[model samples]
Target: MTTPPFPAPTTAELAVVSAQLGRTARGVVGIAARCECGNPTVVATTPRLPDGTPFPTFYYLTHPAATAAMSTLEATQVMPELSALLAEDDGVAAAYLAAHEAYLADRAQFGEVSEIDGISAGGMPSRVKCLHALAGHALAAGPGVNPIGDAALERSTWSPEKCRCDDPGAALRDVEASTA
Candidate 1:
């Protein structure tokens, strides 16, 4: 199995992630990225789940705010816009290919599975499918790793530099409302 770049998940981290996702955290191998308040923002999951299911998404966005921001962008028809860029910009296509390679390398750490081989999320190297997945990879890999993800993040209302979770009470209320 591949080792996650981030630290192993603490029980408390998993709890926070479950709260963030409004579901039990499954196959989470590491906390890929954290909010300014030190809560999980992105989680690195196993390539293959415990049930032997091949899950291609290695980096998953966990923070409600980040997910919401990506959703909003998606609703604005950002996917096609970005997909057009991918079609027209050779540099972007190359970078996206590199991102896809990076994703494959990262997942290879978990062990190579035929079912998910050469498949990277967010329609890498060709199209933009899921901004959340792209953003998750950006957050996990850091800036400059995934260009589309970086672009989406740059256009987002949220920023890692900002401490949006400074107020736990507010964050909890928002999370509760989202889960509800």
Candidate 2:
């Protein structure tokens, strides 16, 4: 059995998530993953939000640094390369299919939504569309879950193993000190 992905988000954690997002977070059900600095990196959102919108993406990437890194990877036009691999390798295709199933199963725990019944984000079970969603899934599900997500993360500049959120001001001061 797969481990549960959603861990209820605390009020303080929600506040930080809202700050990171630069807006109020809606339909956030849980914190799927956290950074080394203890900030929420991936959030599990509700299938059907209170606003009655059918939000299919349950595993939402929340960490600014990680989101920025995924954006950087996307800017590099790496999606085609990843998509090609999905077509060329049977093993990779199988793993991606499994990731789609896992994603659907995770979302189903909240309740079924017909609009997003078989739809998993980032074009899972077929292709790679969004690095942010894929990376979020990998972070939430942990290693060995989302192969494309893992590869995208591996090829990117960021790593969950390192916490870049630590002491931004201190780093700035160091730069100024050296320049002085």
Candidate 3:
């Protein structure tokens, strides 16, 4: 079994996360990142869930605002542009590979799941697949650890330095209205 990176999550933290996700947040072990208002922005989930499922996503973005921002970027086709950058810039490609390795290392600290081995979320070490996952890693690991994640965050409307935790659903509502 993988040991959690930190202590178990508090009830309040889990509640906030559930509210942000609009569902019961499962397999969450610790608060990886928090909003300025102390709400969970990114959660560190277990590699293996309670149901004997092999899960891959270690850092999960739980903040509604961050999720919405990443979704907006994906909707606007930012992934292709990031993929092109990976293809064109050897430095970024190398950094991305390092980021992938770092992600694997972080997960290893908890435990390893063979089914999800070598698989870091957001298509790490290659193309960008999910900005939410990447942004989660960026928030959890901090800036400069995940270059693509940092880039995505740079292009996002959300800012971690700011606190929008007061109304978790507000950002999602805004995203819905904008998309509508």
How far is each candidate from the true structure, as Cα RMSD in Å?
Answer: 4.5, 6.5, 6.7
Per-candidate Cα lDDT values, in order, are 0.86, 0.86, 0.85
Q: Residue 177's C-alpha lDDT in candidate 3?
A: 55
- Quote the lDDT for 66 in model 3: 89
Please provide, for model 2 over 144-180, each residue's C-alpha lDDT reduced to its tens digit, 9 standing for 90 to 100: 9999999999998988778877663343344445556
lDDT, candidate 1, 88-111, per-residue tens: 999989999999999889978877
lDDT of 3 by residue, 1-180 (tens): 456556788766677678788998889889998777666789998899889898899999988888999999999999999999989999999999999998899888878899998999999888889999999999999889898999999999998888866664454345445556
The per-residue C-alpha lDDT of model 2 at residue 78 equals 90
Candidate 3 has an lDDT of: 0.85
Position 86, candidate 2: lDDT: 93
Q: Any residue pairs clashing in model 3, and if so which?
A: none
- How big is the positional error of residue 171 in model 1, measured in Å on the Cα after superposition? 8.3
The per-candidate count of clashes, in order, stands at 2, 0, 0
Task: Kindly state the number of residue pairs that clash in model 3.
Answer: 0
